[model samples]
Target chain A: MADAPETFEEFRKSFSYGERSDLDFKFMKSLSDDEAAQFLAGLLAHVGDAYDHARLTDIIDYVIDWQARAYAPAPDAKRTWVYEEGPFATPAKPLADSRVALLTSSGHFVHDDDPEPFGVVGMTQQEAEERISEFLKVPPELSRVPVSFAPGELRVRHGGYDVTSAALDHNVAFPLDHLHDLQADGVIGELHDEAFSFMGAAAQMRLQKETAPEWAKMLRDAEVDVVLLVPV
Target chain B: MCHVSVGHVGRAIEEAGIATTAVYVRAFGHVVDEMKLPRVLITNHPMGRPLGPVGDRQRQRAVVASALSLIDSATEPTVVDDLGPFRPVGG
Candidate 1:
């Protein structure tokens, strides 16, 4: 490969489309003056070696994608909602009453609360479990126990803004895997069919558009009626 | 870490005109103040998994219900009351 890409297209098409860390330098050039400056600073700080410039470029590209997603025009028609997992007694039943939920990823959560230190909530294990139990309304015996939770933090300068972001202390717990288990076992009245995991804070518009079609299709496929988002 | 892409996706879906409800676990206070999105649920949970820890179905259901309720209740951007910190049985 040449030391520097001559065109934006050449730079954008250089990396694999899906790798989160790959930097599309061409995309960086296309950024508005503000975005471009942020991209360059992030590149210099994260990409210490010339060889790693491509990776740095990918991160920048991801940021650009975030900008696009953030500013995209709102759609006019009612779109379908999808969930990843939940309880549905009948697979063929209509989802008119069903709701879609969103779960946030640790990284994006941090960005949402930029400048705040990670795990500032200082939630204790007892507090975490109690909150989980209350949120789900599950008996102590049926609830999945959390084993571990940790925080991840990052700092980046973008668009004349300095961002110091940190993920909440992430907790890893056993899966309450079966939706039916809740209802069949008398845990709740209905199973929602699916739940969601969110990392929206990390998403760029370009990438979201590329990925949204699948989620939209999932809602269509499952015939979901409502979407419920729970931010991490 | 909870990736930023997730929020964008939700926004994208919302922009697509779907009646969407976003439950922000930790940044509820910030989202309500900053973005001006509709039907938001606020909690002080971590990222990646929003409905509280992973496998607690009851909490998940409540969170879902809270978010769903927002569909009809949110006339403008609104934030549901906080569920506060998690506590184990009778703690």
Candidate 2:
């Protein structure tokens, strides 16, 4: 484990790094800022003795269950909770000699390429959140961006998390800039001419069954040897 | 959900014969296990900033480097390297 956090501020930062779910978001929404602080304080009190990964996991599990029981209108159940099996592939060649491509779920689109990509372009944040489930039912739209695409022309639209940081610097989610830099430094052999983006906080059935296979074929046709997936 | 969706996408791409490594915020590794992605590098950054905080190129490069290491070294299904919480300097 990393060094145990010392103060509440430190604890908060540490906790933020942990994984979160819809339940956690709703549970947090239910808590006032003061209550949230108190909860953090309660957790902070146990930092040293019983704060290992397993124990923290147990606590989180307990809180999730408690939230389900305690809240009047429980957090909306995730409609698509299916976990289908997936296939794997081993690298045919070393990274130093293989062509690489990037695929991200950061909801980025070219500025003028698609005016209303994902159908949530002009909607307010409130509207997008209200209808995100509906949006997920649509087939995943792959936004094919050339590696040479200008970073200044990228625009982000995603309802699952705060887009402020991504809007400011897409490298937070896309990382194409760094990938290009790595390519220039010969960390990898070559960057594929195209990078891919799509909204990932979706039901995923269509993505898995229909769209993803198409994406795979495209990458294969392009002779990409490796793909780096960055999920926001 | 992003982790799960991205895992699915990675799976399809890999199944097509190209190797893949998913870099995602650490949430629901068990689900990733169920999906059986070939390799994953889980970071403790927030959901939106999976690479790291915005504008931190050094930190983002560290994440990509970690992912590359996972890709180069993984020998089985679901190889994971959890690089714990990367705090930006003086944040």
Candidate 3:
């Protein structure tokens, strides 16, 4: 285990620019404040529309039962936080000059993107449960689509969290429009032709192992310089 | 961006040689720091609504601006630009 750093500055220097075997399952309540000179905890000012206690109250109990089993890891193994000898990349140019790609892990897909039973709304309860079980059982995979894909065709199928805001406007999570605005205003130079979405949270261990590299390949394929990640 | 947990993916992309940034729930700010994610702009809007609230163009645009700007400015591990304290407007 790595010794903890007392301050942000110390924390930055202590970690030998590498990864270590440490668990990341800290709880989510009571984040700190941005009130004075110091940085705040999770920095959440207010919960958005679709979120409430009903959804989050069971997180500790549920994720242990849900995503923990999704990848079929050995007991006592840390499934989510994969360590790496990271060489963190930096932006080469100003935002207005970089080709940007956006990825959202909000379980979003256009209606036509679903092949068969995956998005069939009227399936029998047994069928739905079985399909969800299968979906969760497999390793993580990403759904890629053209940024030009119609927003009206977008729909969210994730059961992990409230999708109300995303259901209202995909921009809440997959802000392709906002990105376009950025492009228009010269905040970012170019928007990649494609955008990607993963089905759920990054806690789905399979994502870190398989799907991420695939997404990285796509970003590389597009000559993307800056990528933006937004969560739901 | 969508799930607060996706910061790891941002770090992966950064590792892949593309600089990255994210906007997520403020509650996970410390987690983002510990994971040493690239440029992140965190907001206090509810969990799923990381880009401000639903249908609020100004807030969403502002949030996106802050996130993108991290590319131009951030030079350290897991340094954050907190957009918390800003209220999302709608349901």
Candidate 4:
């Protein structure tokens, strides 16, 4: 077994904020002075050994779960379009039909696009959905959100039994369904027929590029107008 | 879709000349002074998931499109707009 964390603070530090700090900074910028203070207060309140591993995990998980629901898309806000240069560009003319495709990979099934390639892991759609649901349960509001699986080209090998079972399960790290739902509600106006997904983390970009053409083709076949890529 | 820090990815995308909008959930009705982007949306939702609940296809599309539309409609360098709530069905 590994050495126990030196202290509660040490264990907390092990939670690994790394790039997540960047995410937090962005989140802070979006807040008002008072709101920011409240957020910081919440974070401060949970510090120290007041909670154990399971409890801390639950707290962190609850924070993430709360944030997802709190950040769920609003309907009245105006939407904007972003078109990447090179291959993916918004056409000069709007698409006649606004069909969009949703794409995502089973969590833990890391692909080339993932920044941290933990490798592949076998998981059924049902298992992935259940895992995602459990993840959302910490924050009750998110329980209402649904999960959908759209066929796509990205694939990876199962990490196998030696790997921790948790490692093989889909983490659903991002709020993908929320993004897709926004698209379908006419809030996004138009969506490409096919959406794309891969394992979460930093290393998956390579796989994403290689697989992009195939996804593009899928969108083309579906006569999709705008491809909305969601990070899950 | 992809929840990124505004300062980190938002500016990078905008600096690249690609139109970009940052959506702030939970900070709704709150004014942000440091935002330098072309368009931004503020709502009362949480972070990580800018668009509401996962798997709600209809709601996701609407949020994405609304963010995209700001690019064409925004008149100022930094426009701050509010999306009241995530009422996907009737509202």
Candidate 5:
């Protein structure tokens, strides 16, 4: 009935919780940083010892997603592009006889070459952890990994989803470990020495035009029979 | 474009005359279906955690097993195998 409150403090007095009107935002603009930090910290503790911020962020994302799914169903996305009919290729050998390669669009990379504009490889372990912690908390800045990537060099840089769990165990996205498992059990014959992580979501048209061909050549050069592409 | 790139990359490798199978979620699976690559496997997993849920070893292994199998079983370009949704641990 009265004119709208002009100042934020005046507006707060006019607001009520759980109002189903235009001003019904559940989160408050004036929320304190300590409050938010503590809240997220508690959530992080639930997923890990609280030291591993990456895993905590990932678990929190999945948990929040789980809760949201229980509340409402997401609508199907519309397709914008109609692809032309493309090539069809099949495996030439049996599972036990074929060599496999791993490819993922999860924005993961080996941190060796250059942590880049945000590089942290040469930093102390604690310093690297601190930098990576900042990386996960902030918006993602992805890098192109160079040759000579090893298992311990794994880093998750995807902005589309939580990198926490993937940070703790890089295999969740890349699954190079599982590839080895398959080879050990003879489910697959062997793994190529190289695998790749794409900093996807953005730079996509570039991927289609240039990067995809390079990836194809890489896989082809590996003598890979089945290229297992795991898209995030 | 994040999702459709999967099909693009798959198409690229397929063009190389090598077998390629895409593992992805529903909406993107629709794109993969529309694009119609060499082999496709649909799974109901989260966006970033495509192989399976985070910290889930056995589930990841299950997903990998089924996805790789599609490489062998897909007789045509249109074949799409769905692995359904992620079942939370102990659910």
Candidate 6:
């Protein structure tokens, strides 16, 4: 424990894969340089000196599994079909002059709006699961969050991943404030007056078939030149 | 939270004549490629913090700026841009 590796290079040497796949090693290498630093700092700081190869591998395995489940499509969802003409759209204007909008999948809504995001909140674990199972059978609605809304004026309602980070600062997931900053800097012509959000872990089949066209039409009607999609 | 759903939504938006650039975790690069999304920016940050760490305004701003830039540069469908490692304001 006291001899836990201090660097990723050192850490890499602690394990050997004579007959096993190196999938886990590749996953660890995918961490950005700064993320790697944060990963090591947090591991060394909180894990203290009791780290071992098995323990570290267990952490990696858990993360891999969690992410796999989080991003997998709902069972009821079938493969998505792309637009025949293709989905590429050239910006009609430069970013610095284009009206940019943000559309997030963070399941956020204005405090007073009281949107029901799959109605999973406050229910027991079993109840929530049942609610989500039924909810995923269709496309969910979207909430329009004002770009200038205050902190306490917003609320989050999502089932995937812990919402604490976004709860502390909605910008972590939505980034509306930063978009506003970019607009102020003239990096973008304008921040669309409203940003949109919705629960993302739902039926993609229904989303593409029904809800998505409506979202597209609305943004198109607003003359939005470019949209940034942020998925929680 | 759901990169696949986001990709589908982005596709719909693009089909409606609105340019779209989606931010996705690098871990899901395979899905983005498989789906052939119009435009995408890859970030190595964790799932919940797609832009960056909480309250780290500098990094978040960088991510947003990059996404906007991608809108201007991408000339074809399925264009993916790697934001590379995040370098803080003055790390």
Per-model TM against the reference: 0.39, 0.75, 0.68, 0.39, 0.65, 0.73
lDDT assessment of candidate 3: 0.62
lDDT (Cα, tens digit) per residue for candidate 6, span A1-232: 4876376544433322212213223233434456555655755644443344334433433454434443445546554543344567888998899998999988788878756554544333233233555657667778999888987898876655456678888887898888888888899999999999987867878887888888999999998999999887
lDDT values for all models: 0.39, 0.70, 0.62, 0.37, 0.61, 0.70
Scored against the true structure, residue A108 in model 5 reaches a CA lDDT of 71
Give the lowest summed-lDDT range of ten residues in model 5 chain A. Answer: A17-26
Residues B4-91, candidate 1: write the lDDT tens digits. Answer: 3334445555554455666664433443334445566765443224455443556655665566556655656566765544432222
| Candidate 4: regions farther than 4 A off | A1-5, A17-88, A103-195, A202-209, B1-48, B53-65, B68-91
lDDT of 5 by residue, A65-128 (tens): 4323322222554555556676888678886788777777776767654444244444433333
Report RMSD (Å) for each prediction in the order shown: 16.9, 9.8, 12.9, 12.7, 10.0, 9.9
Candidate 2's C-alpha runs over 4 A off are A1-86, A115-127
Ranking by TM-score: 2, 6, 3, 5, 1, 4
Could you give the interface RMSD of candidate 3 in angstroms? Answer: 6.6
The DockQ score of candidate 5 comes to 0.42
Q: State the lDDT of candidate 5 residue by residue for B1-91, as single tens digits.
A: 4466666778888888788777776535556756767676666565556677666888888878887887777787745555455654543
Locate the minimum summed-lDDT window of 10 residues in model 2 chain A: A15-24
DockQ of each: 0.15, 0.50, 0.37, 0.13, 0.42, 0.55
Which candidate do you rate higher for DockQ, 1 or 5?
5
Which segments of model 1 are wrong by more than 4 Å?
Answer: A1-96, A99-203, B1-4, B46-61, B88-91
Residue-by-residue lDDT tens digits, candidate 2, A1-232: 8977575443333322223323234435444456567665655655543545435543443343333332223246443544455566888988878899999988887877653635545655445555667767776677888889877877777666667788898888888888888888888899998888887777677887888898999999989999999877
Off by over 4 Å in 3: A1-86, A115-136, A201-203, B1-5, B86-91
Which candidate has the highest TM-score of all? 2
lDDT of 4 by residue, A152-180 (tens): 32333211111121222222222344445
